[model samples]
Target: MTAREPRLLVVDDQALVRSGIVGLLEAAGLEVMGEASDGFEAIEQARRLRPEVVLMDIRMPGLDGIEATARLMAMPEPPRVLVLTTFDLDEYVYRALQVGASGFLLKDAPPDRLVDAVRTVARGEALLAPALTRRLIERYLAAPAPGVLAAPATELTPREREVWQLIAEGLSNHEIGARLYLSEATVKAHLTRLFVKLDVRDRVQAVVVAYESGLVRPGAQRATH
Candidate 1:
C-alpha cells in the first residue's frame, strides 16, 4: 500500500506569508492539513487536526511560537513543531528548541529546502545540522539567561558519555553506530538512555547539555550526517 503523505499545519501571523507557504507546501505534494494565523489558533488547530508537522512562525502575537511549542509538546502524541524564523540569531529560536521543537526553518528558505525541512522533521529527525545548532546554543550561552543551565551528565555511564559526545559532534544515529561498531538500534538505545539520564527532551537538548558541561567545545570538528 502507498504510504500517507505528511500532514502539515502552517502557522504565521501574516496572511500573505501563510498563504504562500501553504501553496508552496501543497505544490511539493505535502498535505496542507490546516493553517493558523497565530499561536493560539495553531494550538486549537493542532489539537483538532493533529498534523504530523507544524511549521510555526516565531513572532506571532499572543502566545508566540516558543510558548505554543511548549504547550503542544505537553499534549499526548504531539505533532513535531518546526519553527519558522526570520533571523537565525533570534533568541526565540533557541527557546523554541528548548521547548521541544523538533527543529527550525528560515522564513526565506527556498521552496525545496522548506519541503525538505518539513519532511525531515516529520521523519523524526532534527531539521538543523548539529554544528549549526551547537553554534546557536553557544551564542545563547554567551549571553546571560535565566534557567538555561545544562543539566549535569554525572549520571551517564562511560559508554553513554561517549555516545553523548558523539551526538554533540553532530553525528547521526547511523554514523554513531558505524563509528562505535554498534548497530543503529544500539545507538538509539544509548541516546534514549542519555535522554532519560540527562532529563532532556531531544537530541538538541542533549547537545546543549554537552556544551554546557564542556563535553564539546566551540571550533571542534563537527560531523554532519
Candidate 2:
C-alpha cells in the first residue's frame, strides 16, 4: 500500500508567502489541509482539521507564532510545528522552539528543502538538527528567557546531565547511544526521563533547557564521561 501524504496547515500573515508555500507543497505531492493568515486562525484551523504538521510564520497579527505554537502543543494531540522566518537569527524563532516547535526553515530556502522539512517533522525527527540549533541558541538565547530555567542544571543526575549535554551538542539518540555505549532504547528511556525532569515537551525544548541552564556552552568541547 502507498503511504499517506503528510497533511499540512500553512500559516502566514502574508498572502503571497502562504500562497507560494502551499503551491510548492502541493506540487511536491503533500496534502494541504488548509491555510490561515494569522496565528489565531492557525490555531482554529489546526484544531478543526488536525493536520500532521504546521508551517508557521513567526510574525502574525492576532497571536504570534510562538504563542500559537504553545497553544497548539497544549492540545490533546498536537501537530508538529515547523517555523518559517526570513532571517535565521530572528529572535522569535528561538521563542517558538522554547514553546515546542519541532524546528524551523528559512523562508527563502529552496522549495525542495521546504518539502523535506515538512516530511522530516512528520516523521518525528527534529528539523533543525542540534548543531545549527545550538548556534542559534548560543547567539540569541544564551541569556535567560522569561520561561526557561536558567539555573536548573544542578537538578539533573550525572547521566541525565550528560545526555542533555550530548543533546545540546546535536547528537541523535542513536549517536548518543553509541557515544555512551548504551542501546538506542536505553537512550530513549533516558530521554523520556530527562524530558519529565526538565519539563520540556521535546528534544528542541530539552536542548533549550541544556543551554539556558548552562549545562552546555557554545564552543566548549563535549566530553564523554
Candidate 3:
C-alpha cells in the first residue's frame, strides 16, 4: 500500500509564488490540498481543506496573515502554519511567531528545505529554521517581555527538565535521543511531558520559557545538532 502524502495549504497573494511552492512541495511527494490568494481566503480554504500545514504569507490583502494565523489557531484542530515570505518581509517574521505560527521559512528556501519543513510540521514539530529562529527570538528579547516564567519549575520531572533544556538549545528529537542514549520515542515522550507541564504548544514557546525561567541563559553555547 502506498503511503498517503501530507496535505498542505499554500497561501500567498502572489500567484507565481504560490504556484511555485505548490509545485515544489508536490514534486517532493506531498499533497497540495489547496491554494489561497489572501488571508481571508486562506482561512476559509484551510477550514474546508483540513491541511496538515499552511504555508502562509505575512502580508496579504483584506485580513493580514498574522490575524488569520491567530484565528486559525483558535480552531478546534488547527493545522501548523509555516511563515514563508521573501527577504523583504522579514519584519513580519516576529509578528508571525507572536500570532502562533509554528515555523518560519524563506520563500526562496531550497526545494529540500521546503520539503523538510512540510514533513517537520506534519510530524508535529515546530518549523523554526535555525537562522530565523534566533532572529525572531532576538526581536522578542530586544523589546523585553514582562518576564513571565509561565512554565512552573516544579511541574517538570528531572528527565523532562533535561529534555526541555535541550529543546531550548534547539536540539531535534533525534539529536536529543542520540545524546541521551535513549530511543526517539523516549525523547518524544519527555517532550510531551514537558509541553503538558509547561502548557506550551511548541518548542518555540518552550525556548521562550527557558529564557524567561532562566533554564537556559542567553549567549550560552547550545549543543550543535
Candidate 4:
C-alpha cells in the first residue's frame, strides 16, 4: 500500500460514533486527526487540523452537516466532506452536493462501506451508494433551483461533456471508461483535461458543475448502462 494514507476528521454529536469511526479508520492505516461533536465544532477543528477528509453528521445542535459543509467549502483548501447521516433523502442530497459534499453515507453503513467512502472522498470522488438515502436525488429535483457552478463556457470538449454527465450520475472512472470505450488511463486523462478546463479540483466538483450548470438533470430519462 502507498505510504500516503489519508488523514480523517470524524464529526458527530455521539461520542461512540466518533470513537468507532476513528478506530475503524486507524485500523485501515489512515490517520484520525481529530473529532468534533457538532457542525460548529467541526468547522473549528477543520480550520485548525486541515485533515484530508471529514466524516460529518447531518444533524447537530449548533450547526447541521449541510451548513458545516458550506462553511468548510468556503476555505481555500477545504477538506473533502463525507456526510454520514440520515438526511440522504432527496432534498438533503441535492443540497449536500450543491454545497460540495464529496459523498453521503449512512451512519449504519457496513464497515467496508465506511472505509470505501473515506477512501473515495479522500481521492476526490463521489460514491454511488448514498450514505443517507436512496430517494434523495429524486426528491431534490422535484422543485429544482438552478445550482451555482464555478465552471465556465469554452472549457470542456464534447466527449468530456459525455464523461461529465456519467460522472454526475455517479459512475466510477473504470465504468465511465468502459462506457466511453476508453481505458481507465484514457478516462483519467480526459478527466484531467476536464478538471483543468473546468477549473475544478476533483470529481466531486466536476459532478456539481455538471448538475448545477444544467449539463445533467436528475429529471432526465436515464441513459442505458
**Per-model root-mean-square deviation over C-alphas:** 3.3, 3.5, 2.7, 3.4
For residue 113, give model 1's deviation from the true position in Å.
2.0
Which residue ranges in model 1 land beyond 4 Å of their true spot? 142-152, 217-225
The parts of candidate 4 lying over 4 Å away from their true place are 130-135, 142-154
Clashing pairs in 1: none
Q: Per-residue CA lDDT of candidate 3, range 1-225, in tens?
A: 965678899999999988988889888888898999988999899899899899899888898889999999999999999888776236577777766788788777789988988788778778775545655565565433444344476677888888887887778888889888999999988888888888778887777667667676566677765
Would you give me the overall lDDT of model 3?
0.80
When summed lDDT is taken over every stretch of 10 residues in candidate 4, the lowest stretch is 128-137
Residue 218, candidate 2: C-alpha displacement in angstroms: 4.7
Model 2 over residues 1-225: C-alpha lDDT tens digits?
977878999999999999999999999999999999998999999999999999999998889899999999999999999999998787788888888999999999999999999998998777885656867888886554434445455577788878887888888888899899999999988888888887776788888777777667655776333
lDDT of each: 0.85, 0.86, 0.80, 0.76
**Candidate 2 regions off by >4 Å?**
142-157, 222-225
- Error at 112, model 4, angstroms: 2.0
Determine which window of 10 residues in candidate 1 has minimal summed lDDT: 142-151
CA shift at 192, candidate 1, in angstroms?
2.8
What lDDT would candidate 1 get against the real structure?
0.85
Which pairs clash in the backbone of model 2?
Answer: none
Tens digits of per-residue lDDT for model 4 on 1-225?
A: 754878889998989878998888888778899999999999999999999999988777889888999999999999998888654464665677668887777777788878888887788776645212224554554433555344473466889878877876767778898888999988999888988888776776676566557666656664444
Candidate 4 scores a C-alpha RMSD against the true structure in Å of: 3.4
